[model samples]
Target: MKELMDFNFWEMILRTTLAFAALLILARILGKKQLSQLTFFHYITGITFGSIAAEMAGQTDVPFMDALIALVWWAMLTLMLSYISLKSSKFRVIIDDEPSIVIRNGVILDKSLKKARLHMDDVMMMLREQSIFSIQDVHYAVLETNGELSVMKKAAQQEPTKTDVNAPITEPIYMPSEIISDGKLVVKNMRELKLTEEWVMKKLKKKQINSIDEVFYAQIQTDGSLFVDKKSKE
Candidate 1:
């Protein structure tokens, strides 16, 4: 127990705290898409940062300053590359690969599939995930850099939009905001919508809702309509 007791707890705590802070800062600098829409290069960078940070957090023999410097330098290099990529289209394509057209005009491009290192089974599975069963249904399928297959269905297989028909559009801009959830009023939404409790009560009264408790859920539509769902007594 002598060696265990002799271990510098305070030093370890400082290292962990510094490493965590550095990680948070680095994550912010890297941007939200680092995890969300990750490319191959970014995926590797994320792993590298995690491994280095993990080592610094627990490895007492590893100097904190050295680790911190390494992390900062890496982040700076990443940012510099990102800036360069933003300026040069060629560099951007080199850093993050361009999307490949795997399928064109309802025909699978065998060469593209081979270059992307994807099999026919992989393509079919991706299509199935997107609710596409028949390859004939797909007009075009682009293999994204992040490994997602973006399929465009043929005209006959696609769903018709509102513009396709001569239907009257009610609201050009439609955004639904929740005003009440689980019998509780969302004050922030109410304030943003510039709605008073009296206004809500009046709307509720119109629907024969006497109390907020009656509402299990409620939302304000873009047309200034209140959609109130009453709690089921059952």
Candidate 2:
């Protein structure tokens, strides 16, 4: 009882609070990433941050300020690398790595699988998750930087739509391109769609939207129709 009473309880409390606060602030500063979207680098960084915070909270011999400084240093280094990666494609490739084409034109690339450190069973499991039963159905299978598998089915295996069967002359169908998301303009997508800011503003005006900030999302359909969703009050 005496030993328990003599323990620096107040100091421990203060250290814990400071460490937790630092963790929250750093997490916010680092920005949001979904668990499914976490890359290898992100996973390692998360573990390191948690370990540092735990040490600061539990270890009394180490100064709190020193631990805090270490935590901040790691975060700053990560941010600097992220900035450099954004500016230089080569740096980004070196850090985050490029996507690998594991399967092309219904043929699996053994070299790519070996380079990605993935086995046949792993690829098969990913294919099953994508609703593909056989490798013959796959036209292209790209292993993304985030470790997600993107599979494209072969044309022969794809189901024909109503237009394909009924129309005398069929036209290529285009996927809807997003031009705005979370009240921010997607300039690259707008350029790809061959749309101007003036045109977007005119469309918004027709929808009684005064500013781009009022929109939650906006997309351009294949038929040249503009779909707009206003930000909800909730």
Candidate 3:
């Protein structure tokens, strides 16, 4: 009980809060790409950041400020590397890695697969996820740097969409706009679409939703229809 009520306990709490806040600010500065599109560098950086933060929070022997400085330095280095990669295509290819053509013109490139450190089973699994069960249907398949497979089916095997079928092209296709996500209003999206909060509220009211908090997600389709998913009571 005495150990729980010590000065070190309170000091640790303060250190943890400071560490977490610092990491959050650094992540925001580093950009959203760290979360959405994590490359090899991003993955390693994330792990390193977490380890450093943990040490800062829990290790009393090591100075908290020193750990924080190290974290900031690492994050800055990552940002610098990202900027350099963006400016130089050669650097980008070397650091981020180039996509490998694992399958070309319906033939599996075994050498490319080996170079990518991927196996036949892995390629087949990735293809199945893309709805291509048979390798014969694949015209081209590239193994992306992020380990995602980009597959193109044979011309004859491709499904015909409305455009391919020569259907009347009505209004220009617009991507759905996310107005609300996880009960939070996407103000940036709203601004981009030139929509007002009152407009979104009116749409919600029409659907018998009293509050924005009741919605889990709300998207406005290209055709001007509001699609809403309410929060489920689990």
lDDT by residue (6-121, candidate 3, tens digit) is 98889889999999999899989989987555578778788888899999988988898899999999999989999998766568878888778898778899899889889999
Ranking by lDDT: 3, 1, 2
**Cα RMSD (Å) per model?**
14.7, 6.9, 13.2
TM-score for every candidate vs. truth? 0.67, 0.67, 0.68
Q: Which lDDT tens digits does candidate 2 get at residues 107-149? A: 9999999999999999999999978989999877889898999
Candidate 1 residue spans exceeding 4 A from truth: 1-6, 166-234
Residue pairs in steric clash, candidate 2?
Answer: none
Best by TM-score: 3
> Residue 163: error of model 3 in Å?
2.1
Better of 1 and 3 by TM-score: 3
Q: Compare the candidates by lDDT and give the number of the best one.
A: 3
Cα error, candidate 3, residue 105 (Å): 0.9
lDDT of 2: 0.82
Least lDDT summed over 10 consecutive residues: which range in candidate 1?
167-176
lDDT of each: 0.82, 0.82, 0.84
Candidate 3 Cα deviation (angstroms), residue 212 = 47
Candidate 3 stretches with Cα past 4 Å from truth are 1-4, 166-234
Which regions of candidate 2 are displaced past 4 Å? 1-7, 34-37, 156-234
lDDT of 2 at 60: 95
